[model samples]
Target: MSAPAYSRPAPESNQGVLLARRLLPPVLREWVERLGGELATVCGYQLGLCDDRGKPTGGVGGKLLRPAFTLLCGAATGARPADVVPAGAAIELLHNASLIHDDIMDGDRERRHRPTVWARFGEATAILAGDALIALGFEVLAAQRHAATARSVEVLAKTLRLLARGQELDLRFESEARVSVDECLTMMTGKTGVLLGCACRLGAAHSGAPAEWAVRFERFGVHLGVAFQLADDLLGIWGDPAVTGKPVGADLLARKKSAPVAAALSAGTTGSARIAALYARPGQLTGAEVDQLTELIEEAGGRDWTIAEADRQVSAAWDLIDGLDLDGPARSSLATLTGTLLNRDH
Candidate 1:
């Protein structure tokens, strides 16, 4: 197949994107080239490797955070980043696959300033593309020659199961009259945390780190993932659309019981009662109501609570990293990357 013609410059500011540029492109190219059909076309479009017309766009896909964690954690075991490319690539592919399905489930038309795969193509095609990506993730990992390959595959499989369960819980929240903050946190951990933990564990395992060290790395990633999701929840309701690439209050429109929403609903404030009553009456909330809901969440202390909790999680992750006896520079890189993710606007 001839190479498609177009190239866009990647953003130079983020460390995760820089590291992923070194690791993901080759694997992504292989997937696009090897699939070689409608599956290839859909996957390519979904991944930002190409446009809907099957022309290469040089797009870099999502933030590449999971793969960056994989590579950085592997480096802690004194392995070169190159040595763990398969693990990083596997985690990345899985993460994108999840995003493809998630956009469909959330009924989101736009992500990263473009139509989502399901919106651009059709739902059936997007589902197939997501499935293909999941299989490719395992295929990439299984091809690795490391002793930890089998174990890594097992971890990946478990993470997928957890992701499915998490999605189930999220869907359930939409219709249920009441959702506790604790339930919301558990759902977030399952949906977001396990995959990141899998990324870190795969990295450490592939690099021949001891089992205990791998567990520690996984825990660190779990904490970081929670912080990441909390930040995302804040953005879902209040973020600038130009920066976040999605409409502000999109989650509120969907009646999603996000962390902040759940926190507000569970609080005993009068604002909380108003929010619950509004949520209970809704067909779809008007734009004005979404604006009101945003304020209600804040007034109920949900916004403040989420911000503090995210900070606490980040501190916990840092403490765990400090206790680990790892390569010094790799540890520093991990810390920098964590700060970058927590502070991002999008």
Candidate 2:
């Protein structure tokens, strides 16, 4: 099943990616080396800083969206980019840790066009690498001597708890006969939104923004995060595998109840009934069956519903940004970055 011929205009260059490429490598390299020996090597490979043979790859790593938000929000508060490096590093490490663990749990073999950590380095090594990353994230935050250091650590801890709860709900949803759209949204907020919100809040707080302004930044990030997850769900079903760096229909093939699938199943239409029947079948779905399920889900209005919701979330986020008392350039950059994220195909 080919995705519809829908395309978004590409940003000339993603400001977030540019910031991450400039700021993250040295920090990641120094901390990852602290792990020592095999653990250090595995973690480095997972972060795309080095090859499996432990040689430097000069890779810029993943999108680094969370860290980019941290840096941008910090800049909004008049902090120098270097001043927020610790916070950005902490968020990026935690994000990668979650990815490693998620790949192991979901049995995904590839990410960012390379074999996942668990696939290339074995599950036990991947687990250790993920744990090490978490420890490193806390260490980075704790090393900060600012007054907001303790509060930043606390925020990151809370985000981790929410992330774990989200993952648990996600796993549980796979076994349940039905899941409400509201429940799915809650799960995604915990799994994806809080961390991004935390990134923004930490940025503002650590950079000396007033408490009230930090709260507003957090709200803006939460909305943006929801929009990001909705976009990801759409990509899971219809995205080009080459662009997404995963197999086509990977979520559908695994029988995971993604947001669109849940919406389709709960639509209560004839197409919904057919989708449910297809999902309820015992064994793995063949390619043709997967294609049929994709068409039925779109026919049942799941695709349109998700697209509309994503747009709504993005608009809400932009409104929040507009109300902030940020400098004109910072405000524009944040809004532009949000659009870049919303328009991404991967």
Candidate 3:
């Protein structure tokens, strides 16, 4: 299973993911890795043996940005990172659940430069694994016995529903003759924003941070989520396959409406009609067709609009960050994480 290397943003070590990485409450990383054991015992095992002497097939999955956020939030609220371990695990598990389900639905065979769970196992097994993750996420959070467990459950449930609604809109857009910019934006919000909000807000919630502060974190997450998704959509269209692990113009090939293409279609420019004509042609697209579609999306202002919109969302996120009474380490780490995400090439 020599898949390509995954190139998403990730903290590299216990020094806090990526060098120049100074670790705060360095023990935070231990708990983060422990989460892999928990997940592997479930979904990871069902797939195959672990890496390097049976280390769990799904060891320390992904960039772990969400759980890190949860831990940082706990630290900011004056709790030891260990105190919020359950919250961290729950957030990450839920996020992974979403990713697995998304890959299955999107027919993505590879992730993290390896076969997706559905591809390795079977679709039914993968679906069950995703469901198990979701339920396990709730169980871990509930076991924490935090005063906010109920609230967290409610938020997570709602976020999952929003994600489903967004996915529905995404599928519908693929077939519809037209989709509005507002509709597309709304879908992005549902698909990407709320879970991030939950991650940030939970940081405080797990530690009984005030409702006011929790709300602020939620706002910050909203801004961050929108920017994050837009950046992802940008990568989907223009990012390198060698780096991003998907073919060039993967989104265009799927003919699914992502931000740039949607913006292009709605721009009412000559490029808009051109894009529509190309999409309507159907069948499989050639490399030349993919290249021309990329050209049309840019001509219709889709690329610029998406970049600007992502920037706008980032600015809004910073505004929220500035208003928080976060401690020094948390603030610095947050700023670093935000920059890393914005700067990611794939």
Give the Cα lDDT of each candidate: 0.81, 0.83, 0.72
Over 17-97, each residue of candidate 2 has an lDDT whose tens digit, in order, gives 578678888998999999998989889988888988899998655767788888888888887887788889999899889
Tens digits of lDDT, candidate 3, 1-346: 1122224454454222431122221222333334464444436432233442236443344566776777776677765665676766677667778888888988988776677878877788778778877776787778777778888878778878887887888777767977887888888887788788888888877766787887788778878888888888887888768767779888889886888888999999888999999989959999899899988998889989998998998888778657667777876777677777776433
Better of 1 and 2 by lDDT: 2
Candidate 2 structure lDDT: 0.83
RMSD of each: 6.6, 2.3, 5.4
What TM-score should be assigned to candidate 3? 0.84
Kindly report which residue stretches of model 3 are placed more than 4 angstroms away from their true locations once superposed.
Answer: 1-9, 13-42, 45-58, 344-346
Clashing pairs in 1: none
The TM-score obtained by model 2 is 0.92
lDDT of 2 at 204: 87
Instruction: For candidate 2, give the lDDT of residue 339.
Output: 75
Error of 3 at 109 (Å): 2.5
How would you order the candidates by TM-score, starting with the best?
2, 1, 3
Per-residue lDDT for 1-346 in model 1, tens only? 1121111222445454578776687788786677888888788877778888888877656767788888888887777786678888888888889989999998989887789999988899889889999999999889887788787889899999999999899888877988998898889888998999898888888777787777878888888898889988877787666566657677788777888898999998899999998888848788888888888998898888898888988888777767667888777777777766666332
Selected candidate, larger TM-score, 1 vs 2: 2
Residue 89 C-alpha lDDT in model 3: 66
Worst 10 residues of 2 by lDDT: 3-12
Q: Candidate 1 vs candidate 3: which has greater lDDT? A: 1
